[model samples]
Target chain A: MSDELYDDLILDHYESPYHRGRLESASCEHTELNPLCGDRVQLQLQIDEERRIQQAYFEGEGCAISQAAASILCEHIEGRTLGEVEAFDARQMLDLLQVRLTATRQRCGLLGFKVLKTLAYAYDGTAGTSA
Target chain B: MENIRSDFPILGRPLADGTPLVYLDSGSSAQKPQVVIDALVECYQTYYANAHRGVYQFGVQIDEALEGARERIAAMLGAAEVEEVVFTSGTTMSINLVAQAWARMVLEEGDEVLVNEMEHHANLVPWQQVVRQTGAVLKHIPLTDDGHLDLDQLQNCLGPRTKLIAVTGMSNVLGTINPIGRLVEAAATVGARVLVDGAQSVPHAAINVQDPAIDFLAFSGHKLYGPSGIGVLYGRRELLEMMDPFLCGGNMISEVGLTESTWADLPAKFEAGTLPVAEAIALGTAVDYVTDIGFEQIGRIERALLVEAQTRLQEIPDLVIHGPDVDHKGAIISFTDPRVHPHDMAELLKRKGVALRAGHHCAMPLHARLGVVATTRVSLAVYNTSADIDVLIEAIHYARKVLRRD
Candidate 1:
């Protein structure tokens, strides 16, 4: 159990992930695939009239890090503004992970974050635009 | 096997974390024996020169060494002539040579090229490229439930209009040893030439290029304990003569002019530009090293290891092995554990200093067919021992505990 990759926190979140389902009538959604290892993370967000992320959920398949990242990111942005979600960067995502990952596996940790950043970066979708 | 282990220096090296190394990725690339390593050094130190172009001392000696290696390798493959062996970068290049040079030349608009799902992409994609280029229909032999190629479907797939059949001697992912001899016999009845991708099977079993009388065979050196960047494409001489060169330059032309050029003879015609000099020589040494150990002893030891691994792995209630029974399989084992995904398990196992192959193992189509995104592969070679398997089982259990609720 010396491997930091499977610490109790990551495994717990992976086992009972938060908001791990389709977000029906989501404002916007984006999916990122790590073709190298077949990891796919789909992040969906619902925006209110105030432009805040009213709801967030994720659907993913693959490594624990990618899936766990999806849960962590979705929960982190549940009530945050679209601007704050767009402002989230790779370093902050790793800071949220609070674990060490080698350069090769950093992609796994960042897959879900990429989806969130991509969707919020555009931010032009209308009501129920996510398909 | 004791003697075999000593021949590979890396087998004794410990991992950086001070865990005793248990390498199980030889299906992707086998470890090099000291003999092969020495041959690589010897090529430059004693016999280094531009091949087929110079007439000086080192040139002649290098030429002799290179051709001598070819003769021995040809004999090992049961090839009728040494010139039938054309060295390329690796298995992918070999298949490309046949597809671009041979298939493109022969295939008519409606000709059928038969393949199966079990083939590695190296064997499958090249045929796909050629068929699209020549309007040949690419058909597949559906796999059985247990992952063997459906030979009964072979009857429906092959006909007089079928120009070629591309098959793998062994499945890289499922460890299924295909019935190449029977397949070749059936292909002959329909007048379809057969190309066997020997990237996995050549290292594990005894095969005859002549007895089955296969039209082409392709394999890589690194997978057979030789250096990387070198592969062989053994084609029938008459067929090689009918096709044009895949790559053209100084080393592969009979005569070249500003406007016109004539190609060189059989093997050299396909091999363009300067070859991988040191790697080519070392591949010969690898062939010799395995020859000295003998396929009989290799097979016996590998069979025992496979049986032991399969038996041990099956004991884990959550683990599911993907392949045929041990009787029809090779030493390779690919499996998925529902409790722990392959990537997580592989990472945790690496912490314990046991190496394995994860991801699709360059066989994504096979993974798609099996309905698995990825798997963990433990591929054994002569140097691997039962102790390695013990470490593997222990590490796997350790990995599961780390990733699973239990």
Candidate 2:
């Protein structure tokens, strides 16, 4: 049922997204578009000398799944090291949402992780999981 | 409408969740009628042979069938010669043919190709390529606030260097039925050729290339209640004769030399390699089906549906229809609800089996012009009815309830 995807938790995050503004003095930044549906996501992360993600923020325009997932993923990775963020696979992203999305919605739910994957793919880190 | 609706079997089909298919995505691709399906089946079952390659029994029957289909389609388009209607993979290929073969040959540095943002990428991108390669400039005729083209500035846009005016007969996104005749006239004033992207127009409206003197027309069969992978590119005889062939292979050549190969005559000159044999033959049946019903009836049915859809959609608050009012547009209605994202609307609406397109509808530039990222699209066809709109409205309400704060 769609209710599973539109659960209160996801909706809560969508209505009030976390870490969803510009990050000044960002060490890493990337913008990606889910070309399949035209969702725009820009990720800005502040990493410390220890390679720990000091701050994570995202700004985007898209569906609830996309917005909500970005909120959750940013919060989840705020204090984590870059290695931990790269280790976070697509499965964890969907599980983090606590919902099983239909195939199309899966793309929406994974927009943030895709941006992360791009950072990993850019030789910033060795991404253990194919996001 | 019931009789016509029954001709398309997919309408009767229910999704896995047991919801009836309330298809509003005809603008993407229309559901095929039984007649078209039957023709496709019959061709494959009875005589499925490589086109223009065989001399056997199957070849003769298929050739006759294919040619008969082509002739009927040509007549339907009011084309002067049957040879003018060249079979293409789809509208995309048809437009690309002209872009590569004709535009590349004619355009020079400092030449201009006038176009508008409402045109699907299929039309705009090809001309952009033509301009980029030849150092020709691509210009836009600014769109009206109501989504129509601003014809007032056309004279200023037109000049001696304007080689072609690439415009859509109807916008795939805005649903605005452009005045092709006026555009064609304006192009003529500048000694420019006009290529009408008829992918959306030919299915809903009647057009005659001869009367308008349209230099090139491109449209898809799938949108016209026909099988996919078959489309038509109608070029003026004089223009086609002078242009180079786009694709080269076994069928498109007149004679092969050790170092040089001459192109075949019109029609065959463009069709290279083996064709989509069954789909092309079935497209004949699709044209016949539409012809027997006639454009007058098709227009009446679609206009009524459009009016009903527009009125109902207007009653809902916070929903902004992305195009002009129904009076100025075709049966397409694109809208965005501030309370719900279009992707969520489309996804939730599908739970009730209402299939609509949600995105820029392949007109990304138009979306940018509309000052929106995406809008949900609902397009009507001849087979659609008031009940289908009712279902769509109810589904929209359901989607809103699911996705919105209320």
Candidate 1 per-residue lDDT over residues B136-202, each given as its tens digit: 9999999987999988888988888898999999899899998888888988898889999999999
> Candidate 1, residue A84: CA error in Å?
1.5
The CA lDDT at B347 in model 1 is 89
Give the top-scoring candidate (DockQ).
1
lDDT of 2 by residue, B327-406 (tens): 88898999999978899999888878888999888899899999888999999999898988998999999888877645
User: What tens digits encode model 2's per-residue C-alpha lDDT throughout A6-100?
Assistant: 87888888999898999876777787788777888878877776778888899999988899998998899888887787788999888999988
Query: Which 10-residue window in model 2 chain A sums to the lowest lDDT?
Result: A122-131
List chain B TM-scores, each candidate.
Answer: 0.98, 0.99
Which parts of model 1 are misplaced by more than 4 Å?
Answer: A1-3, A128-131
> After aligning candidate 2 to the native by TM-score, how far in Å is the CA of B162 from where it should be?
0.3
